[model samples]
Target: MNSVSYDAAQRITLGMKASDCRFIMDEWLHRDAPCTLTVRRAKTKGLLCVVADINPNENPDGLYFLSWCVQHLNSRVKVDIKRL
Candidate 1:
């Protein structure tokens, strides 16, 4: 599994709307395999965790789109990609 974690610069909402997740799953990542988005509160900031079965190195464009989608939602957020 591969995961990307986003840490927000400023405090924001703790969770993403279901509609937004649906948009990402059904619209943005529709071509590739499905993924999971998990949102949590980190102290005063927000954290978004994206987990997918695909390896990011093998699909840079998909990763880019995923990152873009997250950033589009919250510009203040920065991403940290991880492989597991």
Candidate 2:
């Protein structure tokens, strides 16, 4: 994808919004590659949060982690891919 599209995609996959996007972006870029991402959309608060964990023996690609998370959730809770 192009740079803007790629960044937009990443923002969606990261569950970032305009308010706190800078902090999230900073944290995401500061993280080294070969990381795993955890995306949570809380039912109670109706908030979406993304956390990246860098550990061995886990799926190392960010996109892979996103796919895995979607599979794991099994659409029980909605993952908003179109946001951002």
Candidate 3:
């Protein structure tokens, strides 16, 4: 399958520490490395692949990426829409 586009994917820039998560949307969010988010076909909740992290260049779009992690799954992770 093709990789999911930023728009198709749920922005997840909420409440996540910029230091922890790297933004990749131009000035919207900076990243040391582009995050590769993969969709899980699990019968249960799916998880994201948080492979590597980078550094930020500009402000984040608030929403970073979708909740691929189980911890964030089905939960409200806070982040600035402007950052995503």
The lDDT leader among the candidates is 1
- In angstroms, give how far residue 59 of model 2 lies from its true place: 11
RMSD of 3: 13.1
Superposition-based RMSD of candidate 1 using all C-alpha atoms, in angstroms:
8.5
Residues 1-84, candidate 2, lDDT per residue (tens digit)? 312123333333444343343444455456563454455654446456665433223343665544454454554433344423
- Model 2 alpha-carbon drift over 4 Å, by segment: 1-9, 13-33, 36-48, 51-60, 82-84
TM-score-based ranking: 1, 2, 3
Question: Distance from true position, residue 31, model 1, in Å?
Answer: 5.4
Off by over 4 Å in 1: 1-15, 29-50, 75-81
Residue-by-residue lDDT tens digits, candidate 1, 29-55: 465643334444344333333443334
Residue 3, model 1, lDDT: 43
TM-scores for the candidates: 0.42, 0.34, 0.21
Candidate 3 stretches with Cα past 4 Å from truth are 1-12, 16-65, 69-71
C-alpha lDDT score of every prediction, in listed order: 0.46, 0.44, 0.31
Pick the TM-score winner. 1
